[model samples]
Target: MLDGLIISIDAMGGDDAPDVVIKGLEYFLKTTGKQRKARFLLHGDQAAINTLLAKAPLTKARSEIRHSDSSIEMDAKPSQALRRGKGSSMWNAIQSVKSGEAEIVVSAGNTGALMAMSMMILKRKQGVQRPALAASWPNEGGTSVVLDVGANVDADAGQLTEFAVLGEAFYRALYKTDRPRVSLLNVGTEDQKGNAVIKAAHERLSESQLGLNYIGYVEGSDISLGGAEVIVTDGFTGNIALKTAEGTAKLVGRYMKDALQGSWWSKFTAFLNMRALLALKKRIDPSGFNGAVFLGLNGVVIKSHGGTDAKGYANAVNIAIGLAESDFLQTIDVTLEALHDEDDNIGFIK
Candidate 1:
């Protein structure tokens, strides 16, 4: 029900340029099956996109194209990308957000290049040193947020605290959870187990009167065990934690398949439980959670997985539309301003 929501897409950024991107649009339309007020702005090679859009009437009907001849390489360094950024689809897609022609920007591109372009084009919010990459964690009860997931290598205490605030705002806006239990991801649940920066952030979050449900520390094992609704950590550890969790999930799945197909009896038992197994797979599939939000940016920017297919990419687009329609940026602005005043400069959004 948004008035004029327009989402910008970098059609050339993904692995299957324009092909998967157009299918992603069709997937969205077919899945939703409802006429939406939102529009699409695609930046890519016009001829290439036109060829793909032939099969995607819903997207072609409500979309416009901005032609760009080039695309940033998947392995391109950030400096190389920034130097040759002009006229690239990724750059133009981000420019649409900067020009206010789009409410949100979505890219299935190189994370580093996309982040670099987003930072240069949209800049960070006031009082934010480096924006964090926030993503959803499939917790036991429902979902929770984990922040600083590969945004920066490391962060100081103040930066970590700011990441917590940004992640809190993200969780609140997306999940509509009030007073979410904020917790620091540490090696152990004890107060004295983490590094100096994490320890400092823990103390700050605990002592602040910012009205957050600060619940101290949680170990990596406790993250999916529903330890807290918002988990905060530096980029280095958070990235490793997330990747490890994903790898472990895949390992468990592989083991289950191997065991199920080992013997005739095992195969029969597996057949009996196929429905339950499929349900479990659907529950924990990573493709459904393909979007990673760039928090603390001046505008809404989402990074979809580079290898995601049409279905996965559709979820990313859905997240973009949901965030835009909910005015999540306004929620972040208001939340930070209030927390900043209440915590005597502890929360950084000034």
Candidate 2:
């Protein structure tokens, strides 16, 4: 039976599928600590998921299994998965969103396959030349929205402007921010530093009366310095920056751990400052922002980290719920129509 808000889940898509998925759902229900009326349509191998659900009373109560023996592999190519992914857990989860059986879909499956299937199934929202993936980035001020993070490797001027639109709406939806500052990522903040595509996109944003807080260009260092609330770029550059930041966080964590345990004095100081250390850890933890959204889609789909724990998965689920409850899609549609109208007036779309 359908309940309050239905979330479709690819239960067998993650690295620790079924087990982690069930535990994550349980954590989401328990931690919310309110009268949440959310239910789940879990698509996966019923036998495996049932075994886990037997232990997770909260999740079992809220989730229903849509049995599918097949699942997409972590390393499977998008093309291959597309050819043979029918009836798979990932496929069914997306299908639920397409068929209006669920408000949103969550998957920790192969990114390529997930994006491919989402595009094929849900298609693109009107006025969108191409869809972009947006990620929640932890920064000095707070979380910033960065796109197109590995969705479209190369975006032209028009597509880059579209990313700005998509990212602005996304930042608002996720963080409840009003009038998020949008900026283009480039080598330098100066107008002449970027290539032709970047310059063209910048010109368009600056001239458009789309009501965006279109700030100028921001460099890599500015990303963590809260240079702008929404940083827009091509997927090639954005993906590299994302990976580099992730790796650097891990490296810093390792270094901190080593220094904290190097000697008795270090250990004593670490113990004495345990509270601050934990606060710092929580601030930098990637799991706190685990959901990557494939924006500009007809339906909402969240891509959770494959290796994330229960906490990370819960964060993703929370994002899905928040979007489901908001008028995010309508806002996007209205803004996109404005952008298209403006573009058409100046022959920008041509």
Best model per lDDT = 2
Task: Provide the lDDT at 26 for model 2.
Answer: 91
What's the true lDDT of residue 264 in model 1? 100
What TM-score against the true fold does each predicted structure earn? 0.93, 0.98
User: What C-alpha lDDT, on a 0 to 100 scale, does residue 234 get in candidate 1?
Assistant: 88
Error of model 2, residue 66, in angstroms: 0.5
Candidate 1 error regions (>4 Å)? 1-3, 33-35, 263-269, 342-350
lDDT of 2 by residue, 64-124 (tens): 9999979999999999999999999999999999999999999988999999999999999
Clashing pairs in 1: none
TM-score of 2: 0.98
Clashing pairs in 2: none
Please write out the lDDT profile of model 1 over residues 43-102, one tens digit for every residue.
999999998888799888878988998999888998999999888999999999999889
Name the weakest run of 10 consecutive residues (lDDT summed) in model 2. Answer: 29-38
Please name the candidate that would achieve the greatest TM-score relative to the true structure: 2
